[model samples]
Target: MKNLLTILLLTFCVSVSAQTTRKYSNEFMNIGVDAAALGMSNAVTAFSHDVNSGYWNPAGLVHIEDKQLALMHSSYFANIANYDYAAFAMPIDNNSAIGISLIRFAVDDILNTTQLIDDDGNINYDRISLFSTADYGVTFSYARKLPFEGLNYGINAKVIRRVIGDFANSWGFGLDAAIQFETRNEWKFGIMARDITTTFNSWAIDEEEFATVQDAVEGQNQELPETTELTIPKLQFGIAKKFIYRYDFSILTEVDLNIRFEENNDLISTSIASITPSFGFEVGYIDMIYLRGGVGNFQNELQLDNSEKVSFQPSIGIGFKYNCIQVDYAFTDIGDQSVALYSNVFSLKIDFSCFR
Candidate 1:
């Protein structure tokens, strides 16, 4: 009992200082909406009241008063990352809602190899295997209205997992939360906390760096002479605002932030620990459809060298809602290739009302 708490404290401190997201991005980057579209504004706006709220801002669910279901999928030409997601939500009361969401990230066709030491001072390479990662998880979300009439809040906790290959896999837990406020139905604001947990599964670790033949499998590191437990962080935040025009149109501007607490140089985040700030905007017509765009991760300016610095992930998307059914599509492009490396996503939702 004492030892577990100690390990958690260490992981939290390390994960909070100058945390780098590159290593973890590949494993779960596409967990949200249309990859191509999300890629455009630096993947901001997780605190959105749309089909993607399942992966973005779980608190956004409270705004959806009717029963709803949505699904999204993306295709990447580079094949570096690919995935699909589906979700459903239902309002339990005026101030509360419940939902379930699923996610899958797949990395296909990887080369596998084995390293061996030759007779003397040489080395031999053996082709051992090839595999990719198929990670999936189910999330349960609950949203409610705060005591304040204009305030709404939500919470989501998920059991996540990553299967590298048939030989090894790791599982952990994650959480997301959000709060939103409105005034006169013309101006709205939002705040959210993302990925507040560093998850772990049964895995192994070695004290001395040496060739290993004894693979005891699950949590092998637990029995080693001495091993340090691994953990991410418990912090991430975002802020946003929405505007409505007299012409019956609206616009939304948002900034999203994630902080990796890299308090110390550890195996998880030394090579790449930095803060990412993203920007996004959306224009809507009659509250039924919208034209959206966003640019993210910019410390100074936007330039032509988008490929190298990601001046900003620029995206354009459209959305439609009728009779409580809403659908949205966003195109994410970064000048990555001829096809533009875009993500295509669509979602279907249903809404119902009671005590009217």
Candidate 2:
């Protein structure tokens, strides 16, 4: 027991000291995948129980009694991009489980033009071409119940890939670890360390493709740096409580604190001070339907010195379940105004154990 506590303390210390100034190394990894969890503002680190938990907190995968598969899709950034995810989990025994998940985000048909010919000299529309930019990650996860009752631990190993048209490509690897505990009185707590080993992305850029504009770019006083990106670790902690009423209704409330260590000059340099808090609630009608809502990303208050509104992005969602299949829909907050702030996300989950 003392040894475990010591290890945890050391991990926390290392995470604090490993802060970097490199930003957006693997930024796409921060986008929440599952619609249900996003609708709840990513406050599920302690409450997640479905296959999608492989991404949120792999330790939650231990709750799966059988085999489950999940898929999610979103048309993000005002329909300018597409994001998709798929996950599967299976219990190995009463005490352990394994899972896999895939995430993809892409923006296609981007017009590639070195110079807008019409705006400059020629009127050649034929010079224009289209290409796509994409980011992808494959995650393998394992979870096991600890010897101590109500305690669980998990880990995730991931491979990340990114491409920008035919100009640049990057590949990287990362690992994540998490622990969760539940109390007899329906209270749950969890901690997740993302990119625990620090993800690194090494980019291979085609410099020849930009040779034509190289002198012009230099004339503009902009110099491109070498192509390596580092992603610092992010720590997430959550607490949740469930209230069951009668036998047909239940309500769960959860909150999470997120501390991200990055190389963002726009924010303060201290890891402990750069904290974001999120809150969420879920109400269930038996096991058939669910309603959820939450708020997130309000930490700007600290960076902005409270000069601007905290911009607490809010989301809402609903889910329906019957027999072996479940379907969910959510409206995730994406912008400042209602007209542009909300995006639709859909997900489907299936349990094969019921068929057996």
Candidate 3:
């Protein structure tokens, strides 16, 4: 199993290097943060008002009432990989807010078998070792309300770091801009533009470590891998509304359109761009307990029989809020409607007012 895993990893790396433009570069950062937003299939772009908004729609940060802290954790691939997130947000003034967030995704303890077959064509179990691959991101965000009522704008500066044990590492930078608007009638709209400046990653590979695997496979690893990776811009547009049936009961519905400037398997694909639409709803009682559900990641997949079929991911979650603390739980798919098993995600949020 270890050897097979190593082969797979190397193959993936080679394939990525062969391509001039990778469609999924730095993909781990695309994974949604905050259990509540994940449960809603990331449909909260229009109304993500709190510390979590730093990762969703930074424009919502202006809605922060006070100092806030957030945390989340999830496991993927049956615990082979772990994803974690944390964030802090505070009101800088009456109409401005600032926040910082961090995210990490990692796969640890993978057996390195390149050295198993030592010099002289001898198999040596003692040569085996272990290593890990991990990706990290840090974002600084700021938001302020506009002079116009119910209008706000925000921006984010992101730093990305990736490591593959001692073999390779990279550093990247990017920027994002977003805006949110609300109407007197409670309808909301938002736009989030990610990688607006086209994120760039520069990698440094240890040639000595990589040399061990150069001959492990035929016609592969013949050249050094590409040192630069680029992530193009993506846009998300959202609209939402809330319906109150009484002072204590309410329902919120939202829709989001995600646009990528590439042709892919998304439900709506074209040579210029691809668009995927997601829908979600939340039901709340007395602002204390909540239930949420969503469907997203619509794709047209090719079957083994040369047929095409539509598939989507479905997610559900629950949340509880009391005073200044809130906890949320979600069951979601990390894959694009491909994985049979789902992952559980949990997140917590606390308002500093609780201490005062």
Candidate 4:
């Protein structure tokens, strides 16, 4: 049975990865949940070593010698949205580990008002209702170290669910694959295949109660004939090196390249135009306090004339560790924004082995 399940998973992943068609759905997957990674502009693909690695690069989970759990919460889009993430990783043996993670992104209590004829000619605002939209994902991940000392492979199987008020909903399933290589020195490299098997979200709508839902999009000049959205494959590459300055101080720098494959688009120009390269570095002092900063999502600025763009998204974070408890804080701007939509993430992690 175990062999059969493994074969089935591999087969499905291979089939989806081979698909060339493109679809952009469930964009919430791109949001960074790890405070440490977000602070460093999401450039931790090669050096991710915490429980949050279950989402970034599962291969990094093998680096956890003790059972660890991490929790994170953040507000996005100026507090209009709520996002929460949690992950727990358990080392199965010297060569294998497993993890589980969950993420929920939500916008709550939206006023649902409609334009309908009342008995009188006047508009009716008294009947307005409230609703909410939310996106959720649950993932199971596993990693194993290869025979070689520094080589590791990992995979994640996830299920996605999205709900719009109680009118419409969607369900999706996808897979991710990752590999990490660490040199004897302080250098590391990583490759992550997101949606390796293109993720397909199948949406359902109640035509009877929500017949106007389709018409609403049509009013905006969009077609709503299709109920399925296929997420194309995205590949990320990363490299990092750590420099030891003094006995108690060290610096780590990393960069990541993001590439997305489309079915019928210009592979080169589109890749170049759409890609958001990330660069970040971290400074550690005495192995207890750390400072991290990085820049990313510059594709728009890079393509436009310099005079047109004013602010580029940047992020900064600080971390403190004592024994088995670690706390991290990150401040970032999703884009050019005032105080209204500032993005801040906080994470707390604890290692269970400390108690054992």
1 versus 4: better lDDT goes to: 4
lDDT of 3 by residue, 1-356 (tens): 34574575575475336245567788898998998998898899898899998999999999988899999999998888999999999999999999999999999998878778867989999988999889999999999999999999999999999888877888999999999999999899999999998888888888887776665644555567788888889999999999998799999999999999999999999999999999999999999999999999999999999999999999999999999999999999746675656799999999998797
Q: Per-residue lDDT of 1-356 in model 4, one digit per residue for the tens?
A: 23433432332223223123445566688787778788998998999876888888999999999999999999987688999999999999989899999999998996554333244646677755677778899999999999988999999998999877656677999999999999998689999999988887777755433543333223322233345668877888999998989689989999998776643222133633335578999999988999999986653222244443323468999999898998999998755532336788999999998998
Clashes of each: 18, 1, 0, 1
Question: lDDT scores for all predictions?
Answer: 0.57, 0.79, 0.89, 0.77
Q: lDDT per residue, candidate 2, 305-349, as tens digits?
A: 546434567889999999989998888875562334458999999
Which one wins on TM-score?
3
RMSD of each: 9.6, 9.9, 2.1, 9.3
In model 4, which range of ten residues has the least summed lDDT? 11-20
Q: Rank by lDDT, highest first.
A: 3, 2, 4, 1
Q: What's the lDDT for residue 161 in model 3?
A: 96
The stretch of ten residues in a row with the least summed lDDT in candidate 1 is 209-218
The TM-score values for the models, in the order shown, are: 0.66, 0.85, 0.94, 0.83
Show where candidate 1 strays beyond 4 Å.
Answer: 1-31, 34-47, 77-80, 108-132, 184-186, 204-231, 234-239, 246-248, 263-274, 299-310, 336-342, 346-356
Where does candidate 3 clash, by residue pair? none
Q: Give lDDT: candidate 1, residue 320.
A: 81
Per lDDT, the best of the predicted structures is 3
